[model samples]
Target chain A: MSTVLTQRMIELQGLTKRYGDTLAVDDLTFDITPGCVTGFLGPNGAGKTTTMRMILGLDAPTRGTALVDGKSYRDHRFPLHEIGALLDAKALHGGRRAFDHLLCLAQSNGIGRRRVTTVLEQVGLADVARKRAGTFSLGMGQRLGIAGALLGDPAVLMFDEPVNGLDPEGIVWIRTLLRQLASEGRTVFVSSHLMTEMAMTADRLIVVGRGKLIADATVDEFTSQGEHWIAVQSSNPAALAAILTDAGATVQKVDDSQQVRGLKPIEIGDLALGAGIAIYGLTEQRATLEEVFFGLTGDSVEYHGMLGSQNGQAA
Target chain B: MSIADTAHTTPARTERLAVTNHAVPTQSALRAALVSEWTKLRSVRSTVWALILTSAFTIGLGTLFCWAYLNRRERRGDSIRSLLFDPTARSLNGVVLAQLAVGVLGVLVMSSEYTTGMIRTSLAAVPNRTVFLAAKTIVLGMVSLVVGMVSVFVAFFVGQAVLDRDGLGTSLSATGVLRAVLGAGLYLTLIALFGLALGTIVRRTPGAIAALFGIVLILPLIAQAFPEPWDVRIGRLAPFNAGQAMFSVRYDPDLLTPTQGIFVFLAWIVASYLVAMVMLSRRDA
Candidate 1:
């Protein structure tokens, strides 16, 4: 496993896809290394699926290359052995039984039927192996997709929006499965628009916006980069706001509280104490992962809701 | 990177195989794809049902037609043998209906993948586009050929047996009789390939079927409306009429010879396949 992991890596360099006048994926580059789950974060139409398709050689890149372990995916003699990807779990014939569906895929890659049975057992679909895939619940369908990815037992695995419609139990199952794959030294790259899913499952993140790279960093780094603010509640709000503005801290009044930036909670406390003003409360407001995601993708969101239109008031 | 040390319940045997340095000796790319396609073709209920209907119509309708003809002969007080009526062709009259069944089967084999988005998974596993397409063709062609031949043979024998009771049937040992049966099967196979090519080109079930039926069935009828030498000239070139020339026992001035008819059928198949290949190779899945 270690030997396989050391040699397997996915690299994309200046990869671009254009459909007539629209640029789908524009000049994006990233490397997915083994032994970790790298979350690919992007909004809808951000080229996440396009990039994944290019990596699998399903769609050609108009400009650059997507390489797996130093070679194009098309060049690999045993593609499934090198990389097993579940681009869309629903990409299967509904009329086929689950076992037969996986069997054909396994046979295409020269994998044994025995492995098909094993994967069925592993995904907990053993009892329903003879059932038609069309009848499966969304969670069962996802499990079947993961079974296909593991059929070849490839060194690299990719799942696009794997937990899209899964129940809480199914989502937890996928999280544990992804972590286990990473711990086994497989390069596990998963793509999703949901930030919370990535926060719980991903060790590193490559965030994209408007088909371009926005942030590629560790989860800790990504979360910490969002600006933090210090919130202070004071009896004399206008005087405290003036003092905070004078002290080089940006202040915004919200209801009865004043939000201060560029200053720590202790610093704001000290300022209020020195100015002979009583502070009701001082709290540090750290940005949540969702906020960090929105901040990075604010301008790139193709479909965004109005900030305060829900209540017909501006924020 | 320590899969061996993991405490998860994944099968230990597969882990060993996964960690191995070399792949097991497997079939070549094309052969494996063929095997995969064969597995896929047989596993689907649609394929089985389509082939069953093809057989049922070919044999069932053939018997019905022969029985109806026998009743008409009795009423007319005609002799058992008629020089004008070709017993061989009448025994295989079911080919007309079976053609649609075989054509639909061919279309579904390729079009279902497109509709269900299974083509992406298929192409990802077998990246060589030409090889993948060829494998699909091989599997569909072989299955259609075998089923078509069996269905036509059953139709011929059963229809002949019904006619034989009145001493009006042609035997398999007869020279033109065997050729007609074999030709009917060949025609069915060619029609299936034609349907498959159109399905690959159109990438939709209804559109491809409509195109296939339009060219093979409707165009022939439309061509008959033309004036002067144009009708016979265009009619002979129609794929369906040209292929029917294969089963004819007597020569007609308006119809093509067996050899010429086969060439025209082959031409249509090759043309459709070339167009399909170009489209499949160039397009994104």
Candidate 2:
């Protein structure tokens, strides 16, 4: 089947949302381009959901604009066909059958019923299509939500925490689905608080904190910003540490292992061999995405509880 | 099951990735939204039960009242010609119960969306808020009008059949009889619309239903507690009293004429609908 590639983009220009005194989304400006998955990363309460809501026109922006393909989402004649969003999995009347739930949304956008059946099959929900939505488990509900998103065959798809209640298999299915959608030249923007999850699924990351843009870069670029070091486990730890230190490398000895900086693993190995100190293991390490996420949003975490404290006491 | 397991089971999954680009006929937004709302209303179980109860209450209670009234007149040995009675009004009295059923159905149509957090999904689908609300109103209005007419007409026919056994029944050809019957159906439809407006404004099922009952039923009783002319003056404007004037053939100085009652009832609905429209548009889903 031939696929037509359209310019599907989500552009937010200084989009601001203020609820009374609290600014939920403060001057968020970014563009989500097509042909790749852009991960919307932020800590909890960092305004990720609020920004998505504004983009979908579920909430009015206090200041600036959120445009989908050069037009506001509300301005689209058939919005579901232009951009589909799964804001909340449970945002449907549970008394209705799963098929009927998707049917109504499809009809609203002038989509055919055949497409509804196709989406149900695509999401692996065809088996339970006749069941009431209220009886569905979280994973089933998520699949049903995805079916609704795919009903109109939209160009741009947005999912707010799409994998919240998925099992391992479901997670793998969604990850594959998201990457496949992006590979097909459709714009796929997914929001998640899990940095590790984004690291695996997103080609690009748009990180935010306290409703402010923090970093906008590729996944490799984001990981490269953190500290890098080489871990050396040697038979002669003391000798290697002294040799590595003398060779202009900062080395810290801990439990017969030397953590070396300012030197490559190959350099340390060559130096250790030259010094006649046998090395058992030479491994390079970089800061994990989880650590990098925390380091960037540390000051912006809205609610911080005392860690490892008992009986409401400060630690 | 793992991703490999799913892939093995569904080898045809690759075809699902292709988005259908077939040409579809462009429909008006209002028509699309109307079709969506109709599907949403019928898919739920509550709508079926509510509509069934509406018809059953109207027909069943009307038959019962007609039978009891005839039995009572026979026991009193009063001639049907000597007594002053509005048989049409008496037969259509079941509308009092039927109104609540229709009102509940109306309230649920709008309020359930808010309660289920479905408003977000709904508004996202039909971003034009005016068109969304208009479609919902049109669908609910049409359904209630049909059901109301069917219920009231069946009640009128059956009640007359029972009363006709005693040679005391009124015909559609009688003076003011057809208007009263038609007015009963119109009154129920108005009540349903009133409930829908309240549901949109309140956005909660229980609260909207309470407000509906308070305005339609309790307010009339409260109005009757006023002193002398103030009592009748305030009472005549209440929805329950206005509805009574619409379907009552008997002339009374304390009540409005059928036309006057319709105008008064319509004023109440218009005021509530305006507030509902404002709240629906301005508030976040």
Q: Give the Cα lDDT of each candidate.
A: 0.85, 0.86
| Over 4 Å off, model 2 | A1-3, A239-243, A306-315, B1-25, B73-84
lDDT of 1 by residue, A1-315 (tens): 234325588999999999998788999988999889999998887889999999988898999999997999888756888788998888899899999999998888888899899988788788788989988777777778888888877888999999897766677778888888887778899999999999999999999987999999999998899878878888788888898889898999887788889887887888888989999988888799999999999898755675555553211
Model 2 docking grade: acceptable
For every candidate in turn, the CA RMSD to the true structure comes to: 5.0, 3.3
State, as a TM-score between 0 and 1, how close model 2 is to the true structure: 0.93
Worst 10 residues of 1 chain B by lDDT: B1-10
Model 1 lDDT, full chain set? 0.85
Candidate 2 residue-wise lDDT, A62-136, digit = tens: 999999989998887678888889989999999999999999999998987998888888887777788899888
Q: Find the candidate with the highest lDDT and give its number.
A: 2
For B245-285, candidate 1 gives per-residue lDDT tens digits of 88766666788987888889899999999999988877888
Query: DockQ (C-alpha) of model 1?
Result: 0.36
Residue B248 C-alpha lDDT in model 2: 84
Model 1 segments more than 4 A misplaced = A1-4, A233-247, A255-257, A264-282, A305-315, B1-25, B73-81
